[model samples]
Target: MEKMILNYKEEELIGKIASVDTGTAIAFIPDDKKMSELQINQLIAVNSPRAGTHIIGMVVKMSRRLDETILQNDIDDKKNDDNVVLPSNAIKLVFVGELRDKEGIKVNVFKRNVTALPNIQSSCFRIDGDKLTKLMECISTIAANAVTPLSLGKYFIDENSTAYIDGDKLFQRHAAIVGSTGSGKSYCVAKLIEQMAELKSVNAVLFDIHGEYSDESFKRDGITQLKIAAPNDLETANKLDKGILMVPYWLLNYEEMQALLLDRSDSNAPNQAMQLSKQIMTAKKSIVKGTEYESKITLDSPIAYDLNAVLQELHKLDTAKEQGARGEKAGPFNGKLTRFNQRLENKMSDKRVGFMFSLTNEEQELDWLQKFCRQLMGTSKFNNGGIKVIDFSEVPSDILPLVIGLVARIIFSVQQWSAKEKRHPIALLCDEAHLYVEQNESIDAVSAIGLKSFERIAKEGRKYGVSLVIISQRPCEVNKTVLSQCNNFISLRLTNVEDQNTIKRLLPDNLGNIADNLALLDIGEAIVVGDATLLPSRIKVEEPKIKPQSNTVQFWQVWGKNDSTQDLDTAVENIIKQSKSE
Candidate 1:
């Protein structure tokens, strides 16, 4: 008891609690006090009867209101006295956690439930300088012992101490990094990748939707950059080369293939789908003959087959004629499979989708799937390959979701089928997730197939040693199921009200007020929350050693000093070719 009193006496008391509510305590300030000393979001402590513990709260709002009578008098009189003071001045603080000692070690441990609210008129003291630094150090020590701590930035209240989150939980539980454009979302991702790169065996695949991360500046020993095969590269791409990614059509399951070619509006869609599935199964079976997996392979197996054979079979079905009651009549599938065949042929012939449909005939080899799996899910520590960043910039937007879904489905399937002991944990960093994972209300069969693939992975990926780091600028646009599955969030400044509200709704009720500063935050600063962080904190993310190519252009400076840069003709040609610009 004496020690408690001594500690409280040594601290500078700010005010006394005037009232206590559910999770907030109101404190009245004395007129003589300098209000400028107190800051919103600053941590403070309330004296508790407990022997060695104090109730910690965060200052969220402060207001000074004059009485009606005082305001009327001042308005009636020509002049008002400057010395007069308002009577209703108070500060509201939300109880965050408790600062206490355990086993002789003092730390700021977060707890959602509070045993007791501060007593009315209890003294409040500001936490600053040495006291704040010591508390942070204790928390840091606790986090260090509990999990693999990753240093993010300095704590908002005590800049002298660094902030950290559990690196293990951050990935294992899944995470999202969200912010508006130019608010450092990409930088935060770069920072995380940089930290993970320090680990010798870390395997992360970043789907570069816009090809922004393929910069030569990020080239390093551990970083292996690759791109989806373009229309022109299909003929020359070597089957064994890992630098060019070609996802054969054989990898897509029945539903996914339907998504790409099945047009629900057609009256014979059902017949077309049935014939397509049957032909694909037969095609796969024919290719696996004499192979070890021949007896085990299923219709959905990732076994390459001759797409042309399937087309030929469909053509025969559409043209077949069988004897009827009187004379030769059309077959059951005659003309029904014609439109489906046309759609399939069109998709296969389209050069833009070469990555999915234009693989060399060597893809039919029995070892093709095995080799691609090793190239994708393999780790640098064991296989001398790591950190594959596949650029999807050349993919058309209409089928972007389906294409990305194919890759994710493949990765998940590989991870799921591998022996538990032999599985290498992989993290899929999805940049611009909203583009593919956004909600689609059209009820189209095509959209639902892609949506379901990602939804399943979001729900069950963690148990199979697969993690996702979804990066997006519009939290509202991203799928709710995917966002809800994420247990950690590193949210930068979000100016949109809907986006802000989406993030706010995800927070616990007790700390909902903390999100009020979301729009007010500066660039590179984010509110870190969820299971990975010991406490919900605002941290300034450190700049990555090698940044991504996401920096905003300096329009004003560029316009001030412009020069002749003649490259539009080549750009137009590249656009027409539907390929990357040289």
Candidate 2:
């Protein structure tokens, strides 16, 4: 093969080697020509006695110039060009080598010759300058061939595109979106979901806590929107076509029951809950068989136990103090009582004593308790509704844990039932997850029944088709075990050192530059990584067009403006009139 060569005036020589650095070398090219940055992998001929060969190295850095002298002969020849201006003596040229050692010795230690100079030629394509664009083109090609219904518009295909998600691997498994507040975490999440939802074969269940995703907004294209709410409109509520939320008490495993029932000090809570569950099952079987008992039971049966029934039984067991033969009490019964049956019988007659035997007896107050159990057990329209959003904003703080735990238990139990083939995969979005998972008090139940269950699904549910999307402002507070199970990660602007470190550890080494750019990211730009993408990527996320109305107080305008006396009186009168109307 003939050697490829081109002749150019020596005045075109840009620079000579200034200093040799590890993995790269630097040369100060005079700005007289004002040439653009050189691309990596550009070959330059180096004249050396030991190796008079054309060497090539990729350009890793393009900005800095080092202090070194060039050969006077190369500079003198290049001075003919009007743009060529020599600073002092010579030009600096940096050579990139393929192999540094020759005959088991380093070559840079002794090699010295100066017959040739480094010059830019229009030969080989530069890898550093074009890699990003090449990758984007590859992605665009794959997306164009996608059989899935979603589309990638032309706007994301431009040459300057620095950020893009690998669209091929997204359907392989579930994904996660995590970040601190204002990290554009939500925007990334919405964009991905929007794309997925456009695909006809993909069915997504999004749990929107803030009611950010509504029917009106997500209705474009071929996607359908379903909203679940508490049964407020009694007439049409039952007939409404929506999914149900129900969890049978019998479905809760031993650990879940313990988390649901046992107090902190009860070391045997786990065992006790398990044993009690067995007893309840046995009792339920006996009641179904119509077994004879001392108490005259007709419509009410304690064996018809659910979560409410279990709670009632626990209350009875606690209150029935045993008393000695005369008036001494021993067990939960306050007065003279020895056994649970006797106390229950004694309370049956007196209205004030309260009926303990009947499961739904008002005296036992178990009737009121049955509502929650019925909600979980009965196939009532309210219970089996799709995507119920429980707005606990008005609920008292003391009972919040119980409410969350109860709901979580119900959801888990319901999902456990549907046959694997018939089961509809559900995605539970836990917003402010740190509040539930990190709390020292009243968290064990939710932790065991909710967080642990979700974590298991995160790891194993892709095959089973169940998924979880956990959102949190404080990543440090999230359980590491749970966080590690997440296959996909959408990281937003995180200023916290600990949080950044946590994310850095999860991301691959190739994304180091992308991670460094996190601090300067815009409000809706995020770095997405993990299984759902081909490689780590930075993407600009689109905002939701419509969302639930928020009650943000306009304190500045309200307080800063002068309040008119007439307006104040009118507002007070309107408030009083509204109160009277209620």
* lDDT of each candidate versus the true structure: 0.79, 0.44
Give me the runs in candidate 2 sitting further than 4 Å from their true place.
Answer: 1-63, 66-135, 149-168, 214-254, 266-275, 286-427, 437-445, 544-582
Judge candidate 1 against the unseen true structure and give its global Cα lDDT, from 0 to 1: 0.79
The model with the greatest lDDT is 1
Highest-TM-score candidate: 1
Error of 1 at 225 (Å): 1.1
User: Candidate 1: deviation at residue 167, Å?
Assistant: 0.7
Off by over 4 Å in 1: 1-6, 31-35, 65-87, 104-116, 144-148, 239-242, 382-385
Model 1, span 448-549: residue lDDT tens: 777777888899999899998889999998888988999898999999999999988877777778888899999999999888876678988888887899
- TM-score each candidate: 0.91, 0.56
* 1-582: candidate 2 lDDT, tens digit per residue: 221222224554555554332322334555534236453223343332334233333332344333334234223444432233323322322333322123244221112222233343312222223433443444344444557523222212233543434443443354446666766565555555666654444434444545455445554553333332222211222312332222223333555444544554654444445445555665455444644543443222333444344445545655566557888574632321123323323433322211112222221232332454333322213343233333333222332343444455445454565577765555555665665544234455535455555556656665654566667767667767667666667777777877777666666443433455556666766666666544345566665443333324477877877973346666676454321111
lDDT at residue 507 of model 1 (Cα atoms) = 79
